[model samples]
Target: MAKIPATIVTGFLGAGKTTLIRHMLSNAKGRRIALIINEFGDLGVDGDLLKGCGDATCTDDDIMELSNGCICCTVAEDFVPTMEKLLARDLPPDHIVIETSGLALPQPLVRAFNWPGLSTRVTVDGVVTVVDGKAVSEGRFAVDVAAVDRQRRADENLDHETPLSELFDDQIACADMIVVNKSDLMESEEADHLAAVLKADARRGVQVIRTAMGALPVEILLGQKIGAEADLGARHEVHHHHHHDDDGDHTHEDEHDHDHHHDHDDFESFVVTMGEIADPTAFAERVADTIRQHDILRLKGFAAVTGKPLRLTLQAVGPRIETYFDKPHAGPRETRLVVIGQAGLDRAAISAALTA
Candidate 1:
C-alpha cells in the first residue's frame, strides 16, 4: 500500500491559511485531495467557506473539520480516529491537506504522524507556515526581549512570554517552508525585511515565498516531498521548556517538553453583521480604525458594496486591512465580519464603530 502524503498548513490568525488551502483545492488538477480544517472557534466558518468552492476535486465528503480544540491538543482523541477513517476508506485520498487553527503548533501536530497507526500509512509532505508580512514588519510578534526582561523583573506578576509571540515563533521554527503572505500590503523593503526575519526562524535551506491573498503556484505549494515527519528532530521549537503562569512566575527550564497544551480561551472572537455600506473605502477605513482601537489581532469577512459586481472581502492582520473583490454572491449581500483578539475586547464598541 502506498503511503498517503499530508501537508500541514500552520500560521497566525488571519494569515490566509484557509485561502491558500482553497486555492490548492480549487486547482488540484485531477488529484483526489482531502482537506481537514481545524477551527479554534465554535463556528466552522473556514470549513464552510471551502465547501462552497464548488470544485469537483473537493466534494463534501472530502472535507473534514475538527473543532472544539486544537488538533495538537486533541491528537489522540480527534486526529487519530479521523485519519483512521480516511485511510480505511476504499478510495483513500491521494493527498491530504490540514489547515490548523491559527493558534496551533505545527511541530507537535506533525509529530503525531509517528503514531503506530499512521507512521507507515501517511507521511507529512511538508509544513507550510504562513506569515502576515505587514504584521511582522510592524513588530506585532517581534517583542524586545531585553525590554520584556526588565519589565518582568519590575513586576513579579508580569509573564515574560507573550503567548502570541511564542505562538508565532513556534510556527516559524517548525516550518519546512514559509510563505510571507499579504506582501502587497507593505512596501518592497518591508516585505523583504519580514521575509528575512521569517527565513531566519525557518530551517536552513528552507524556501520562503511571498504572496498576496495566498496566491502561489500549485506546483510550488505542493509536491515538496520533504517528508517532514522524518525530519521533525531537526526542526527547532522555542517554547520547548518554559511554561509560565498567566500571572507571572516564569520558569526557564531545559527539559524537552513534549506535552504541549493550548489555551484557546485566551483569544476571543465575535461576529458583526450589517447592511450594505455605500462606500467600501470609507467602511474599510472605519474597520481598520476599530481594529487598531481595540487591539484586534484579526478581522475578516465580506461586505456588500453598492453597485459592485463582486462581494468585497475584507482581511485585517493587526491594523493593516486589505479589501478585494473575491466573487459574486448567490444570495443577498450584507456585511459579516468576525473579529478575533485577546480576551477583554469591547465587542459592542467594535461593532458600533464598524457599523457607524
Candidate 2:
C-alpha cells in the first residue's frame, strides 16, 4: 500500500495557520482531506472554526482535535492514537493535514512520523511554516538575522534568545516551504525584503510565498512530495538536542532539564464566556482595547449579537482585530473568546473589560 502523504502546518500565534488550512479545505475540489487540529488554549476555537467552515471536504467527522496539549508533547498519548483511528477507517482520506499549535516545535512532531508503525503508513509530504508578514515587518518576533548577529558580537555572554524566537526558528528550520501571510498589511518592498531575508536564512531550495488573507491555491500548498521525515538530520532545532535510546527511539535532553522549553511555562491561555454582545463593532473595539491593555498575543471566538441572527466571529492578533458574521447561531447564544499571551496576564481585569 502506498503511504499517505501528510502536510504539517506550523506557525507562531495568529500567524494564519488556521486561515491557510481553511482555505485549503475550501478549495479541496472533491479531495477527501482530513484535518488534525492542535490548539494551545482551553477551548478548541480553531477546530470549531474549521468545523463550521461549511466545506464539503471537511465535515465534523473528518476533523479531529487534540486540545489536551501541544501536539509535539502529546504525540504518544494523543497523536498516535488519532492517526491509528484514521488509518483504520475503511474510507481513509486522500490527504492528511496536521495543524500544529503556534507554540509547538515541529521537529519533535515531524520526528514522530518515523516511529515504528507510523513510518511505513504515512510520509510527510511537507512542512509549511506560515510567517505573518506584517508582524515581521513590525519586528514582532524579531527574526532579523543581521541584527541578532551584531548583538551577539557586541556581548559574548548575551543570550538574546527568547522562547518566541526559538519557537519561530524551529518552525522555519523544519519547513520545506514558508508562506509569508497577511501580505496585504505590508508594502511591496517591505514584503519583498522580508521574503529575501527568510529565503537567505532558510535551507537551500526552500520557497517563500507571499499571500494575503491566507489565500493560496491548494496546488501550491500541497503535493510537495518532500518526505521530510527521512531528512530529519537537516532540519536543525534551535531549542532541543536529541539522544537515542537502546530501543532506537529518540529522546530529547531538554526534556530532562529543569526549564524544559516545550513545557510552555513562558505562556498561558484562558477562555472568557459571557452573554450576548449588544454591538459587534463596539465589542470588537473593546476586545482590541483589552488585548492592548493586557498585552495579549491572540484572541478569537464566536459571539452572539443582540439582533443579528448570524454568529459573529472575532479574531485579534496583536492590535489588529478582524470581525465578521460567519454563520447562523447553532447553539446557545453567548460570547466566548480565548485570550493567549506571555505568562502573568491580568486575567481578571481582561475578562471583566471584555464582558463589560
Candidate 3:
C-alpha cells in the first residue's frame, strides 16, 4: 500500500500560494494531483481563480474547497473527510496539496496527517511556506523590523512577539522550505536580505528560494520524501502546543484566547462588478486611489477591457498593482474585483470610485 504524498502550502494573505499551486498544476508533467483549498471568506475567490486556470488536473472534482472554517481548527470534521474521499477514489491521485488560508497555522494541519486512518494512507511530503518578499521588506508583519532584529540578536529570550509576528514566525519555523515569493517586486539585494532573515528564522538546513509569480521547477516542490508527519518536532519548533484536540469543539482561539476569528473580523472583503473599462491604466489609477483612501491591503480579480479579447488580470498588494492579460473571458465581459482591507472600509465610496 503506497501512501499518497501530500504537501502543505501555508502563508500570509496575498502571499501567492494559489499562483504557486496553479503553476504546479499546469506543469504537473503527467502527475495526477488533487488540491484542497481552505478559504477564509465564503467568496471562494482563491478556489475560483485556480479553477479558471484551464488545466485538466484542476477540475472542480479534483480541487476540493473547505470554506466553513480553517482546516487546522476543523480537521476532524472537514479535513479527515476530504482526505478520506480523495483516498477512496477508484483512481486516486498521485499527489495531494493542501493550501491553507493566510491566517492558518501549518503545524496543526500537518499534525492531522498523523491520525490513525490517514497516517498509513497519506504522508506529508513537506511544508512549503510562501512569504511575500515585498511585504517582508516593507515590514508589514512587524512593528519594527530593525528593532526586532536587534532585540532578537541581543536577547533571544527577551523578545516580544505581536500576534501578526507570532503567526509569521510559526509559519516560517514550521516550513520545510521557505519560498520568498514576488521577488521581482523587490530589488536583488532586498530579496537577498529577506531570504537571509527567513533562513535564520527557519529550522536549520531548511532551503530558502526566491521566485517571481511563484514560478519554480515542479521537481523542487514535490518528491521531497521528508515524511514531515514524523519530523514535525524538528521542523516545527514554535507554537508546539497550539493545536486543538480531536474532540473538535476547541479551536486555536480557545486555547490561547487568541480570537483568530474575531481578529480576522478586523478585515473585510467585498466584490465590485462593473462594465468594461475603456482604459486599463486609468481604471488601475482609480483602483489605486481607492486603496490609498481606505488603506486596502489586497484587491484582485479579473476585469474585461473594452475591445480586448483577453481578460485583464488585476491584483494589488498595498498600493502596488500588477495587471496582465490572462485569458479569454468565458461569458459576458465585466469588470469584477474584490476589495479586501481592514474593518470599516468605505465600501460604498470605493464602489462609487470604481464606477465613477
Candidate 4:
C-alpha cells in the first residue's frame, strides 16, 4: 500500500500559509488535494475561503475544519478520524496538507503523525516553516532589534523573567525548510542578510527560500518525505521537543491557546451586501487606515467593484492590505468583511468606513 504524502505548513501569525496553499490548489496540475484547516474562528470562514477557490479539488467537506483546537493537540479527538475519512474516499487525494495555527509548534503536531494508525499509511513530506520577512527585517522577530533602538528606554525584559526570543528560537530550530515570505518588500541585500542570519540560527543545513506573496515552487512543497514523529525531539538544535501527558486541565492565555470559546461578539464578521464597491482601491485604503486606527488584527473577503464583474478579493493583515479581482461574484455586487481582533471592535465604525 502506497502511503499518502502530507506536508505540515506551520508558521506564526500572518505568515501567508493560506496564500501559499491557495496557489498550490490553483496550479495543482490536476492532483486531488485535501486541506485540514485549524481555523481561529468558530465559524470556519477560512475553510470557506479555501473551498471558494472554485477548484474541483477544494470541496466543502473535503475542506475539513478542526476549530475545537490545534489538530495536532487533538489528534486523538478528530485528526485521526479525518485522515481515515480522506483515506476511505473512493479516490483518495494525491496529497494532504495540514495548516497549523500561527502560534502552533510543529514538534507536537509532528508527534501525532507517528501514531499507530497514521504512521504506516501516511508520511510527512516536509515541514515548511513560513516566516514574515518584513517583520524580521524590521526587527520584530528579534528582541535585540528592540533593545538597540531603545537603549535608555528600560529593557522590557527586566520586568519579565522569560522572553519571547526563546520561543522564536525553538520555532526556527525545528524547521526542515524555511519559507521567508513577503520578500517583495525588501531589497536583495536585506533579504540576503536575513537569510544568512536565519541559516546560521537554524539546525545546520535547513534550506532557506525567499518568496513573495507566498509564491514558491510546488515541487519543493509537495514531496520531500520527512517523518516528524520519528524525528521530533532530535531535530531541534537548541532544545528538544517536550512530551508531557498533560492530563490535568490547564488554560493558557496566548495566541495559540484554543481551550476557550469565543462568543459571536468576541469578534464580528459579516457581509455588507449591496451594489458593487464604487472604488475598491480607495475603499481598501480607507479600510486599511481604519484597521491601523482601531485594533483590527485580520480581515478577508470578496467584493464586487463597479465596472469589474469579477469578485475583487480583499485580504488584510493588521494595517497592510492587498486586493485584486478573483472571479465574478455569484450574484449582485456585495462586500463581505471578516474582522478579528480584541473585544470592543466597533462594527459600526468599520461598516461606516466602508460605506463612506
Over 203-283, each residue of candidate 2 has an lDDT whose tens digit, in order, gives: 876767777767666755776778899999899786652232000011110110121112234457899999997877788
Q: Is candidate 1 or candidate 2 better by TM-score?
A: 2
Q: Please, what are the lDDT tens digits per residue for candidate 1 over residues 237-332?
A: 677422321122111111111233222333468899998889988888898788767767668889999888799998775566778999997778
- TM-score, candidate 2, is 0.62
lDDT (Cα atoms) of all candidates against the true structure = 0.72, 0.74, 0.74, 0.66
Show where candidate 4 strays beyond 4 Å: 142-163, 237-356
Give Cα distance to truth, residue 103, candidate 1, Å.
Answer: 0.8
Give the runs in model 3 whose Cα sits over 4 Å from its true position.
Answer: 142-162, 240-356
- Return the candidate ranking by TM-score, descending: 2, 3, 1, 4
- Candidate RMSDs in Å, in order, are 17.0, 17.4, 16.4, 16.6
Using TM-score as the yardstick, the better of models 3 and 4 is: 3
State each candidate's clash count.
0, 0, 0, 1
Clashes of 3: 0
How many clashes does the backbone of model 1 have? Answer: 0
**Candidate scoring better on lDDT of 3 and 4:** 3
| Residue pairs whose backbone atoms clash in candidate 4 | 311-327
Where does candidate 4 have its weakest 10-residue lDDT segment?
245-254
TM-scores of all predicted structures: 0.62, 0.62, 0.62, 0.61
Residue 111 lDDT in candidate 1: 84
For model 4, residues 184-269, the per-residue Cα lDDT tens digits are 67898998799889978887546677777665646556765555567876655343322332111101111211223222232344
Predicted structure 4, TM vs. truth = 0.61
